[model samples]
Target: MSSLFKEVDYLRIPYADIKAATNNFDIVNMIGIYHSKNVNYYVYEGELFRSGKRINIIVERILGIQEVQLLEGVSVISRFKHNNIPTFVGFCYDKYLGGYLVSECEFMESLEQILNITPNPSIRKSEYRIRENLTCYHMLQICLGVARALSHIHDCHAIHGSFNSYKIFLDKDFEAKVVGLFENPEYFPLTRYTCYVDPESECLNIFLTPKSDVYSFGVVLIDVFCQQHAADQSWHYLEFPEIPEIEYTHFDDNIRKQMNSKARPFC
Candidate 1:
């Protein structure tokens, strides 16, 4: 009940088909900003000609000799099916188009937006508290949703690679979905602004491990718990100014153990 109502439906689309559907890559229908210059992808909002259903799709153009390489590599991503993962409708590879990865886009906004978008009030304002509507319960549900998604992804023998607040998306109901799976390591260093990156991975120079994901998830939990007050600081630098005593005592022992006074997040 905490998740979205939409069900994932996958479609295998040809290069020509997508070209026609998007009217030779019309820029007007594009939905959101590109994730990053380094990520090499864009999300376009387009209508399927056959069904006329509006779709938010992730498109990646494979460059040069990498076209053939990407076509082979993306086959697995196209088949990914999980509640927390974005649905892969289809993809296309052609001499003109290179290669593209299209997925069902469910993002409303990043968790980072939720934490950072609203300006911090100089004085405690009731409107800010009342308007920003997420409660502790909602926060817990978000954490559970992410954990379930991560567990399912790991069960499929893949690590999210980039797990953090910026990579998490929320639906209208505030249900969380993870993005940035099958990440390119080249963009890893650029994500150092967030403290969710695994210290072990940074120290060892290894890539993609379940342990790293868990560590990142722990950092995300801390961020979620801090709510709108979450500054873009590293986990070690986080400051929780206030803790509701009654609500804090209400959380179970397991949750309490993980969120002790020092704010050490453990998987």
Candidate 2:
């Protein structure tokens, strides 16, 4: 484990510290859960003490993986220092419980949670109500922030292998923080969010590229504008073959009504 993170400058926290911060992985602290093959990662919101100062954090406990398998992803995360990306706080590994990757708890809630469109039945409903009255302007800002984050990642010569709305979180001011980067795209499970997977990658067995991330982002755009999961509309292509384009009518009625003539042209 030491050799795996020797070059990485992030913290190497003790497993006991992580356990104490998260109250022994209590159910009340669990905010999210992500599945990759047989591995189940549980995300918990907690506070850690470092240098006599309290630091709020989000800890993702990775189950069913060896320490060596975590190096690539952890290294990639430590190099990112963009505003739209969550700050990598540190990581902890236990011989019995697998690994834990920690990040500063700067986000209020994930976009999936706030939009109430998560496919995961295990995710707890968001308790934060930062945006009770979401506006079209707010939605545009969220999209723009995510776009900038993607551009930054591409400039760094890395891809967010599994880019989707569920990986996007929001702050109290609606700023976007994209997480879950550097996933092995080829190994990413197709059972969940098959709608967001790029057709080229899914059908042709092609490796995920920057273009694949763009395709997923397009689906995320649809989710934001329609106020629904893109999977809900995945059957349209087969059901209405003649309608080759997504018409203006496809947008959520409330969001469509909010868009003026200028915005209509862009949509």
Candidate 3:
């Protein structure tokens, strides 16, 4: 594993340090879990000490990741420095336990958790919840933040292959921080959130492109504006060859009532 990342300039965290930080993978520290390629990845909020300074971080324990894939992900993430993107600190690899990607945890919760959206009921429930209702202003801010992040990556000639609401994190101020990049296309079939996926890419079995990210972002836009799960609206578009038209009626009832007459047309 060391040889695989020899040329990469990233911290190679010791497995022991990761175990210590995450309290031996205790459930109390675990904050989130998501699946990829039929394997479960656990996200834990932990504190790590580096040069006598403690850093709050998110440690994602990824099971069933190949060494080459880990190396590629690390390489891609290390090049990113956008504010809307998580700061990749390093990685930990264990011969028996698999790989771990570490990043700075500046966010309060994932967008999915804050919005109370669940793609799969069988997945672990989120313990975090925000009492405040999502307003149009907040939704626009999140949309722009994510758009900037996507634009940054696209400018760098990279595609966020697994862009989705679950991959979006929100800080205390609701600033978006996008993660979960460099994902393998082979894992697409295993993902449960088909609504956010590009239908063309799925039908053609082609590699994901920047257009795919845009398609997913549109789905997220619908999710925020409608306060409805993307899956619920996906069935309506399955018969259409192009992206389905999102009508004014699709907006959340509260949002529609809140909108001024002039704003309705713009929206």
TM-score of 1: 0.58
Which pairs in model 3 have colliding backbones? none
lDDT of 3: 0.71
TM-score of 3: 0.80
Top-lDDT structure, candidate number: 2
Error of 1 at 166 (Å): 2.1
Local accuracy of candidate 3 as per-residue lDDT tens digits, 132-207: 4566677788899999999988887777776777778777787888877454344323232355768787666677
Q: Global CA lDDT of candidate 2, please?
A: 0.72
User: Total backbone clashes of model 3?
Assistant: 0
Give lDDT: candidate 1, residue 106: 45
Give the per-residue Cα lDDT of candidate 3 at 59.
Answer: 84
Each candidate's clash count: 0, 0, 0
TM-score winner between candidates 1 and 3 = 3
Where does model 3 exceed 4 Å of error?
1-4, 119-131, 183-193, 232-249, 261-267
